[model samples]
Target: MTRIIAAVATAALLLTSTSAFAQAAFPTRPNTLQGQAACAGYTVDNYKERFAANSGGPDVQLHSLCAGAYNYYWMYLNAIRKGFSESDCNVTYDAFDKAARVVTNFWAETH
Candidate 1:
């Protein structure tokens, strides 16, 4: 009985440690557009609402990846507004264009 209890305790400890490690690893921001947008708290709904408000049109529909790319572009604009160098924000434009192209291509294919 004691041996069984020790084994169970060991298993629980291992699981707890692994879960902690995974949680720590999960939220790391990679040096990429999607990663940056996620770190900045951008979400699909936020993107949709902002796009509609800015365009004076209906809500824009986007896949999660596409929305994230757009959010990254928005982040670049925000950075510019906050006095960041345009050159520093230029990389995000490429990322946004790539994502937008993918979405546009998919739409073209579908319709």
Candidate 2:
């Protein structure tokens, strides 16, 4: 009976630890600006492919916003890797954030 109890306790401990580790592995939000931009782009692309196929994908406004966000994300990332000043990268980062926000909002509204 004691052995069975010990085994059950061990199993319970393992289950609890596994759940905690899994939760830590997945964050609720993107931790990096580039990650956020990619998420925005993915959402926008999914929307265009799934919902706007008949209408020829996203409208001009959304396409412009999403494309600009994706483009700026890569540019900003490259600039940072190349040792650009934070001040210089700020403008690009803001542009990407703004466009990403618009894309996210549009996606939320449509779905």
Candidate 3:
């Protein structure tokens, strides 16, 4: 009985330690544009709404990532506002997608 209890306690301790290590190892700030990617299928108003949604929350890491995505939306909106062209928005969106992929790869490697 004592051996079993000790084994369980050791397992719990290792689990907690590993979980804490993982949380600490994660980057506090986004390392790639992909981490901030959002608003892909959104219209101008929808994009704005999404940005507003991201404006506040409990998670600081989430807020930072959302801020990056909001910046991407702003670029899309700016192109539209300036009457640049659809291609301009497409370019910005493409960049956002690429950045997101980079971030995804980064996390994959870290894990």
Candidate 4:
């Protein structure tokens, strides 16, 4: 009985700790910006900066940070649309969208 109780407790703890948080996909509404096309000026740079900062300023990325910024921003915006208050939107979407647009514009102009 004692061994069984311990095993059950251990399993319960594992189940609780391993519970995954729901990370929903971004919506396809007009509100969501994709790549450097819709966003041209500020989206890329700002996100790059943020990613670098998060990485302790080494400024390395295995994948495109711009893409991550766009996705993260879109996801948060999705949260707001799902029921977050207008004031609680946290403005992350705007930041990412701005960077994406800037980057897009720069590439378009240069190329």
Candidate 5:
């Protein structure tokens, strides 16, 4: 019984630690979140809203990756004005911004 409790406790600790670390790895920017909400909205929520909104899987994953990438632009520009370059922020935004556009265009064309 003691061993089982210890194992469960260890698992819980590991889960909590990993979860915190995962969230920590994710970028943080209220502005970014706001921007994503805006861009994602198809005037109210995103392209998926009109046809199908996949909250997960490849397309949805792509959407998330792109959203995060797009937000980097605002985050970096703000950080820069505050005196930090935030080079990492720059790449994701620029690349993803264009990709989002292309993806949208592609969808518009195909559908």
Candidate 6:
């Protein structure tokens, strides 16, 4: 009975530790600007592609352009948040550039 209790306690502790580690790994919010910008840029790229394929009208295009601009601005904001130096921001810019390239590549392949 004692051995059984010890094993159960050990399993419980292991489970609790694993849960804590998982929570720590998850972000509470957008803490890094560059990461957030990369996510937003990817989202904008998807929107642009959809708009290109099935544009509603000028209004839709205008909205898509504005959204892309917003994500581009967010990239700079994220770079600042991440304490990126002017030169280091090239990394952040590269993320945005890569997102655009990915979308363009998909478009080229599809249409």
- What Cα-based lDDT does every candidate model obtain? 0.44, 0.46, 0.42, 0.44, 0.41, 0.40
Candidate 1 is scored at a TM of 0.43
User: Which pairs of residues clash in candidate 3, taking residues 3 or more apart in a chain or in different chains?
Assistant: 34-99, 34-100
- Which has the better lDDT: candidate 1, or candidate 2? 2
- Candidate 5 structure, TM-score to reference: 0.31
Tens digits of per-residue lDDT, candidate 4, 1-111, equal 344334334433433444334533344334334443423332423655545455553323322444454654654455444544333333444444554455455546645
Steric clash count of candidate 4: 14
Q: lDDT at 108 for candidate 6?
A: 50
lDDT of 1: 0.44
Kindly list the per-residue Cα lDDT of model 6 for residues 1-111, writing each as its tens digit: 344334334433443443221112212223232333222333423545644554567445333533443354355344445444444444334444444444344445544
Score every model by TM-score.
0.43, 0.46, 0.36, 0.37, 0.31, 0.31
**Every model: Cα RMSD to truth:** 16.3, 19.0, 19.7, 15.3, 13.6, 16.5
- Error in Å for residue 1 of model 1: 54
Indicate whether candidate 2 or candidate 6 has the larger lDDT.
Answer: 2
Give me the candidate number with maximum TM-score: 2
The total of clashing pairs for model 3 equals 2
Ranking by TM-score: 2, 1, 4, 3, 6, 5
Position 19, candidate 3: lDDT = 22
Instruction: Point out where model 4 deviates above 4 Å.
Output: 1-65
- Give the lowest summed-lDDT range of ten residues in model 4: 36-45
Q: Model 6 misses residue 64 by how many Å?
A: 13
| Clash numbers, per candidate | 0, 0, 2, 14, 5, 1
* Model 6: colliding residue pairs: 33-78
Over 1-111, each residue of candidate 3 has an lDDT whose tens digit, in order, gives 344334334433443443221112221232234323332333334545654665665433444434444455455444444444354344555544454554345445543
